[model samples]
Each structure stands twice: as C-alpha cells, then as structure tokens.
Target chain A: MNALLTSAVAGLTAAGAYALLGVCAVFTFRLVAVVNFTGAAIGTAGTFSMIGFISLGVPLWPAVVLGILVGTLAGALIGLVMTQWFSEATATTKAAVTAALLVGIVALGLRLTGGQSPKEFPTLFPGSAFRLAGVEVTVASVLTVVLALVFTLLADAFLNRTRTGLHLRALSERPMAAELLGVRVRILALLVWAVTGAFTTFALMIIAPQRSPDFMSLSLLVVPALAAALVGAFRSFPLALAGGLTIGIVEGMSSAIDGISQYRGILPFFVILAVLLWSQRGARWDEAR
Target chain B: MTRTLDVSGLVINRAGLPVVRGVSLSAQKGQISVLLGANGAGKTTLLEGLSGIIPTSGGDIALNGRSVIAARAGERARAGLSHVEQGRTVFRQLSTEENLLVGMAPGADLADAYDLFPELLNRRGVRAGLLSGGEQQMLVIARSLLTRPEVILIDEMSAGLAPVVVQRLMAAVRRLADAGLAILLVEQFAALALRIADHAYVMRRGELVYDGLPQPLLADPDRLHHLYLGDVQAA
Candidate 1:
C-alpha cells in the first residue's frame, strides 16, 4: 500500500539519525566505560550554534564546520575533566558527572539561544521529493540513509583495520592489560570522546530539520538512541544500527494504527527493559555488577 | 655486573596501610631474581610498584640507571619495561594476532613472537579468550617478548598452569635471561622458582627477611621453610 511505503521511507529517515547516535553512544561506552548521558545535549548545542552562525550571515559550510569543531572541543573538555581531573573517581561518580554535564550543557544551550523556542534548522541537502513506486520520497530521506551506510562502513573499517583502532579495542577488553602493553589510555579516551562528540553533532545536523530544533526535544533524542545501543549490548555497531532501524519502523507503523498510538513514546522503555532482562538472564552476579 | 633494574628503600601503601615496606633489591642483566613469599606477603604488590601499576610511597626505582619512579605504567613500558601481570590477562575480545600487535614496537616483526610460541602462530586468528590457560600464558609471554624489553617483571607466571606447562614456561624464561634480559619473577611456587633463580629474597608481612643466593637457601630447607611459614615449628 502507498501508506505502508510512505511510512517505510519516513522510518528510514528517522532510523538513520537514531543509528548514528546509537553508534556514537556504544563506542563511547566501550572505550571510556561511561554511558555519556550528555551526548544529545552536546549535539543540540552544536546544531543551535550552526543556526546562530547562519543567521549572523556566515556561510553555511563554514558555520557547519565551526559547529562541528565546537562540538569536538566540548567533547574533549568533558573527556579531560573525566579522565584527567576525575581519573580516580569511581564508576558511579563518573556516570553522575555525565548526568550533571547533560544538565549543565542543556542549561548553557538554552542561555545561548535566549529561549527554548524552536528555531528553523538549515539543511545542506536540496529540498526535493520524488514519486517512487507510488509513494513520495524526499531527497533528504534517501541521502540520510546513504550517509548512515557510508559512515557505518567507514567506522567499521577504522575499528577493524587501523592500529589505533586495535588499541581502542584492546583498551575496551582489558584496560589494565592494555595500559601495561603501552596503550596511552588518557589520550585514547580523549580521542574517543572527541570523535563521539563530533559524530553526535553531525548526526543532529541531519536529524534536526526533521524535528523541532529546540533544546528539550533535541536533547531527549538520546533516550531512543540509548535504547538502540542497549539492544546491541553496547558492543556491536551493525546490531545497534539494525536495532535503531527496527525501532524507527515500529514507531512509524504504530502511528498508523488506531488506539495504541498515544503510547508511542513509551516504546523505547519497553524495548530497553525487554532487552536488558533477556541479556541479564545469563549474567552472573560478578559480571552483572 | 650491569644492573638493569634497581629498587632501593621502596615503600608502597594501599589505603594508608603499607603493603610493601622498605623493600630493596637489584636485578642484573642475564640473571633471574625471584621474590618468594606466602600469600599477602606483598610480592605481587612490590612487582606492581616497580612496574608503576601502583604508586610507590617512598624510594626510587632506576631502570637502566635512570630514575623512573615518577613515570606512569605506560611510560615505563614504552621505556623498555614490561610486566606480565598475575593470571592470564590477555585482551579476550581481540584476536591472538591483534593481541600480539599491541606489544609490537614500530618496525619490529612479529616473527619472533610466533617463533617463540608456535601455538600462537597456529591460532593467530582466534580470539585469545578461547585459548586454554597454558596457551593464554604463552600468548601473554610472547606478547611481552615482542616489546623487546630490557627488564621484565612477571608475577605468578605459574599460577593455574599445569606442572608441565610451568616447566616449559620456566625453560623459556631461563632462555630469555640467558639472552641478557633482566627478569624479576614473583612466584608462589618458591621451590620451583629457586631452581631457575640466581638471587632470591624472601618477603614477610611487606618486608624482606632473607636475601641470599638461591643455592644457600635451597641447601637449607629449614631456613627457607622458616621464612615462608614464619616459624620453624610452623614449617
């Protein structure tokens, strides 16, 4: 049906954003051992900064570059604080710091924007739609899907083929052993944080135009993203992407149904709970801790 | 004799309680210095302090005649110190080849590691976690060997290994020492370690109580037993 095809395209667009965010979240968690609750806020800040620069008459490309740079620096600052300033802090304390950072960055973004009102986010992609198999498909939607695939492939290659990527994987597996083997834990941690920060921003740039580019909504997008990461057990990139797409499709399909559509937002919670329960069923006490 | 590693007046405190106190020793090139002690005697703690895994409260560590007391664990490793920690601590998720790559110095070939442990060569593509205990030990040792370290601090190398595997590892370690690398070994198997050790020190409750050639201690079981068990009657 045309309705089914339209929803599928819409689902793919949403899936691209969710998959990017999920990959970033999972990568950061594996490398730094922190959940990085501030990821969405950092992306939201970058998106707003790009829009502000565009309004100030800066060229779109340069403004976009500056926004990404700002996001990267912000991520590095957070990493420095966590790895250097609070290196000896417990895992619980470090996680609490990330939560606090989420609040702080969101507040800072609100102050910078002067209000929580929605701003028109710009898109670099051309505004065009084409009829495909009797359903309308936007160019942005197709571009987003392509970009997601390309980024995933690039990320996968970097992790599997590069030397620094091996070091990252080593650190994720056994940090003490990796350190003893001469992996620079601090520098690598900073790099992971910076990359994820920039990546989250890039993903937001694509997704922001599709939603209201406001502080709360943009920041809360991390909820579904996290659900996707949890679905992958915070390790597998391909699985995380698949999980994101599946969630997006389910959400899109649910909206077409009658009575249950009101509870669409609660979908992530159910997915998170189910996945966690299933995964934890075999986990020993020591491992679960 | 050239001293490769020297730790003098070393003291380490964990949570305000001294774990390694006033321990001093030196390892010479082409010799194996074994630190023998019972559980909780701080042999592992002393090895950790030397490798910069744990901070030393007081004293100095000079590696190749340079003070490395202020250097971190990774820095010390890059400066030619390697620690094979207690237990088989490989990157379980990484392939055996990739695990070796972690210790491969730039421009150095992994051929030496593979040559030293042929089993690793056979299972190069497999994840290290799937390897048996002895194989994992071989992988860990081979990985460290690829670093071409001047001094190696190995802790409990024989732990959880079969007797035959322990003998094989000891032979490999002896070969390494014969090749002019200083080896500081911490072992729970005191008798087995003494067979391969040149110099020996006994630790009790964080302090060294006996320091002598292994031959004298090995000749006098009563003294060695007293040192390990605290009293002759206890022995």
Candidate 2:
C-alpha cells in the first residue's frame, strides 16, 4: 500500500510536467489548426541548450532563462510559418509540416549532443531526498508539481477571464466571422504562437534533469500530454490537468511491478486513441466551444 | 467640402461577370438616398463594390473626392464609409459590446452610439448569434452608428424583419440623417424604403433604370407594378 501511495505521488509530479506540455500543444494546435509533431523536440533542444550553457561556465539561473527564451522564440517561428505560409495549406499539408518539423528537431538534437549517448541534465534543485509523512520525494519533483498547478490555474484563468483570451478562442472557432468583426486574426494567431513557445521552453527547462536530451524520448512526450488535452476536449484546462495527473499516476504505478517500465509509456497513447475514436463517433471536434 | 459619395460609371464583377454595370449614383450630405430593386437586381452588389469588399471591375468610387478603388475593407471603414451589410451580418462569437467597440472609427463619439441604442448597453455581454433576428439587426446598426461616419451605407435593413422592428430601425435611420449624416440604403421593400427616403433610384440587371423623388415611384402603381408587382398581380 505504501509502495502504491509513493507511485501515485510520483505520478502526480510527472503528470504536472505532462500538463504543461499539453497546454502548449493545445495552444499551438488551436491557433493555426495544426498539431505540432515537433513540440517535444523543440523542448529537448531547450534542455540541451541549458546543459551546454551551464557547461560553458554560465550560472545555472541565467542558462535556464536563456534556454527558455530561445526555445520559445523558436516555437513562435512555427506559428509564424503556419500563419503566413501554411495559412492556405490543406490539413494534409499541415500534418506534413508538423512531421517534417519533428524530423528536423530530432536531427537538430543529434547535432547538438554531438551524437553522444543519453546524459544526465543539470537541475535548479539540489538532488536530495525529502520526507513528507514518510513519502520520499525529490526537491525538483516537488517544484515541478507545484509549478504545474500554478501554470494550469493561470492558463485556465487567462482563457476564460481575459479579453484577448476570449478573442483567441473566438478566432480559432470562426476566423472569418472574427475578421469581419474587425479582429486582426493574423496578429492573434501569431500571439498564440509566441506565448506557446514560451510555455514549451519553460516546461522543458524545468524538467530537464530527469532525462537525457534525446529526440525520440522528447518527441514521445506528446503521447502523455496529448492524452490530457484529449480529455479536456482541447477546451477545458481543468480536465486537461486532471487527465495529466491520472496518466502520470498510472504510468508511475506500472513501474512498481517488474518488467512493466518497458511498456508503461504506451498507456497514454492508448488512452488518446480511445478518446479520439470515441469523439469521432460522437460529435464533430471543430465546432468550437 | 460637404460629405458626398460619388460612384461614377462604376462596374462590378462577381465571378468574372459584370453584376453592376456603369452604375453612377450619389448621396449628398444629410439626405436619405434609397436604392429600390428586386432580387438579383445588383443592388447588393453595388453596395459591396462601393464598400470595397469586392473589387470594382471598372469606373471610380470617390468619397469627398478621394478615390478608393484599391483600399481594403477595413481601410475603407476607417475612412468613414460604414457599411451595415445585407443579411445583418453580425459576428456570432463576439459580445454585443465588443462588436460596438470594433465598429467605432479609431476614435469617435461612442456616447452617441449608447444614446442612440440604449438597449445595447443591457445586452452588451451577450454574443450576437443568440440574439433574436430583430435584436441582431439592431446590434449591427447600432455598431455602425458608433463610427459616426459622414456617410452610412445600410443594405436591406428591413429585410426579413417584423413590421414593428422595421419601424424602429427606420426611426433610427431618420435620427441619424437628422443629425446631418448622409445615408445610402438599399432596400427591396419599396413602400418602406420610399417612406424614409428623400430620393430613390431603381436598378434592373446591374444598371440604374430610374432616378427621382420617392413620391413619384410610390404613386405610380403602373410603374411600381411593372417594377416589382407583376408576379403578385399575375399569380
């Protein structure tokens, strides 16, 4: 029972990370109607940059900040391409762009690492065990979980409470109508890209220490995060965060048993596929909230 | 110089076919100039062309002597030619208040908008899609008023509306005109359009066929019959 409880808490921490990435994915997808297949790779690139900067004798704080800023700008460029060049592209073409970008990010990651094996990443938090009611937890994991909650809450409030937030959602729903209503649709789309870039950069930078910087592992991050977004119907942040936590815990618990870790990552992909199939059979996804 | 919209020898094409051919018209300041026509008469097309939504095939549109053949829709809007589009096109996703704010020229008399349509203040937060047809029409008109343009172009304000709603809208148009703003309205409801218009023009197959005072157009049953009532009388 203690082991189960430990796994759940660990899962929650991991869930937080997934939630952050998922929100960024949702933002980018809604802005330009393209699901970014390269989001994780962009994040991994940020992680590698942080490591490189730190190794170059830069302070950890500045390195992390610079890494995040650079990653975010890169993400915003993805939005720019979608708005200006890909605006007229069909769904197939949009998907192709995402696939190409994903491949490019992977190639970029290999170049950054000099084609070396997976290496441990630096962390802002000291690597030490702390006990919370006999539950052992790392400081980095605690910070990740707390930051995730804050980020999700802020995101939800922004989407629902702010004027531009409402405008963004409305533009995504019916861009033509919004344009006729005197909205600058192009600007709004670009802003979404810029903000999501920052989000993915920060999310990757925060959790870099847990895994080595690699293309395959970073790209797979979408599986779990996308599961959370699917749970929210890509409209409700609360649902997305809850879905993230649940998937994290499930993955964590699977690791408690022998030989399960190898297949544990498949859980989110299965959940996402099931949700997609159900939604497809139920109602149209593009009708907007 | 006084505000005037002069579209001279204006030709408009929809899908490579001329819809409005050499249509020249003018609405002087403070006058309610009306366009009378049946469906497919190119009245709406003329408005769309003058508003810069559709590119003019040939001819010229000048507002106070400034040509606008190549201006964008928003740019035209900012230049003081406000179009309350046909079918009362309201942004379904925006709140009524947001719609009003968007319609206002970069800076104009917003207080006049509120005073003109006090009902808007109450429904400011409501998305326009859910409003009743009458309310939606009112909202669209109200937003246009916020721009306080020298010339207001309203197309088919009375279309598909109840008599009472049409009466209220006509009253608002009169109010705007009384305040010295020129109004060019394209309306199919001949009797209603004639009642508010100082002058009226009739269009047939993308050309202005008649131009005169509203009384002559309204009193001539034979001409009116020939213009709009042939089917009703025959049927």
Clashes of 2: 1
Quality class of the docking in candidate 2, CAPRI style: acceptable
Instruction: Give the DockQ of candidate 2.
Output: 0.23
lDDT of 1 by residue, A59-87 (tens): 99999999898888888889998887665
Model 2 Cα displacement at A222 (Å)? 3.3
Q: How well is candidate 1 docked (DockQ)?
A: 0.72
- Candidate 2, residue B35: Cα displacement in angstroms equals 4.3
Fnat for each predicted structure, in order: 0.78, 0.13
Best model number under TM-score: 1
Docking model 1 quality class: medium
Go through the candidates in order and give each one's DockQ: 0.72, 0.23
Q: List the residue pairs that clash in candidate 2.
A: A72-A197
| Model 2 CA lDDT for position B226 | 67
**Lowest lDDT block of 10, candidate 1 chain B:** B226-235
